[model samples]
Target: MAEDSSWMTAGAGECAPSAELHPEIAHPARIYNALIGGKDNFAADRLVAEQLSAAVPETVAGAKANRAFLGRAVRAAAALGVRQFLDIGTGIPTAGNTHEVAQAVDPSARVAYVDNDPIVLAHARALMSGSGHGATSVTRADLRDPEALLAAPGVRDLLDFTEPVALMLVAILHFISDDEDPYGIVKQLVGALPVGSLLVLSHGSGDLVTPEQAERAERSYDPAAAGIHLRTRDDVARFFDGLTLLDPGLVIAPHWRPDTPPDAAADRLGIYTGLARL
Candidate 1:
């Protein structure tokens, strides 16, 4: 596959449900792109992502680390012989997408990516098309609207709800506020799946950073994007209430069965990651 992507269509933007969605706002996905040094972001998103990066200079690394964890987690899910995947808050596409990783482990893997961003929907759909790609789809919808996401036409077409599916929520929880009932949202989403399903999730953390730094980062992301509610370790762990946490439990990112040995890569393991089986 020729990997360099152009916009799924030049008219994709104008053709979206509405043309009023301001491209000027600093959305989470675009901010993330800025942190990763990608060109898919707007100037506003770069400003905030940079501000947060200044507070925790590792914000860039933090974002990249979360992405790395997503890949490792997806591969782990496929290794369990679980071939269906439901990836929510699917950020702007880059290296190692859930379908790509899952399909790499099992060519027959099926995936459905959900996101509220039109840009993400457009790009992901482009890559997921054509044959020999397993079965993959993209849904433009909110995480809070789990029902809508689950009901999306493409989701129905690709994933069988009756089977064990890996539910991926990497680096997206923090963007969802408690007021939005993120916990309830997760519970309902997981509740919809059958037994042996998995919830492979990750969240940004404020544990190692000073309170002031965390607050500054939060303030930096406020004007646009979901306001950051960088949770404590226990808080992050709360998202996995009903499921059994896999070995190593909920821990720092670099600590989760890291590709690198324990002592050598200890310093960068600040992001919290976990793979739970339901």
Candidate 2:
């Protein structure tokens, strides 16, 4: 899809200062956007995406699979009667966003999108503005600081803690390194949700690649704000501890309750995805 310049025009004033965006450095979200054939990215982000795609031919396909998993997971949550959603590490607005999918299931469903990236926040705010979706709100917050993220006025105001919520961490955790205590971060956030809440998560895996290929993929993010940390199936499964994993638990992205038969290219994708109930 072409880059929608309309978001920039609508949210020009809301965008962060040039210094904050750091267009010279590649960000995971922006690179992912580029990999998915999006135009809202800088030269640096595109370069990284190109390098990764060259090394791993399945890079772009993997990104699309991850996005597809997110859509299916959200629809499943909505079908299960989840009316509230807290989506942290939300990347730049794209099609089939959390609010779009959830609200499509039930117009009254509320969605709170949290991301530390100013560009993402600006675009999200602009999209929500144009959609006239009063139940949705966007907040600028980091996943590393769950306390502040959960307490942000935008998040607190729009979501009721007493009710069930769909906590979406899709395609975001891989950006967090081991020192950052990714597991602890997830546990803290999941702890805050009421019983019956769901956790929708997807993370990149190195299991399908050779050591050399994995190294090359990691190097592609050298210029970015954060380095990639691909995990094993066991490591990724730990994130869902204490929750009830749904059918086809903790499988590769394309295999998780696939809406349609996955093609040959789908097997080469390296993302692991699953949904669990609290």
> Which of the numbered candidates is closest to the native, going by highest lDDT?
2
- In Å, residue 120's CA in model 2 sits off its true spot by 0.5
lDDT of 1 by residue, 30-121 (tens): 88888878888888889998798788887887777788788888888898889999888888888888878988888878887777776776
lDDT tens string, model 2, 143-227? 8888888887667877899999999999899888898899999999999999999999999988898878888998889734779
Cα error of candidate 1 at position 211, Å: 0.3
Which RMSD does model 2 reach against the true structure? Answer: 4.9
- Which candidate number would show the highest TM-score if scored against the true structure? 2
TM-score of each: 0.89, 0.92
Question: Distance from true position, residue 50, model 2, in Å?
Answer: 0.6
Candidate 2 off by > 4 Å: 1-19
Worst 10 residues of 2 by lDDT: 1-10
TM-score result, candidate 1: 0.89
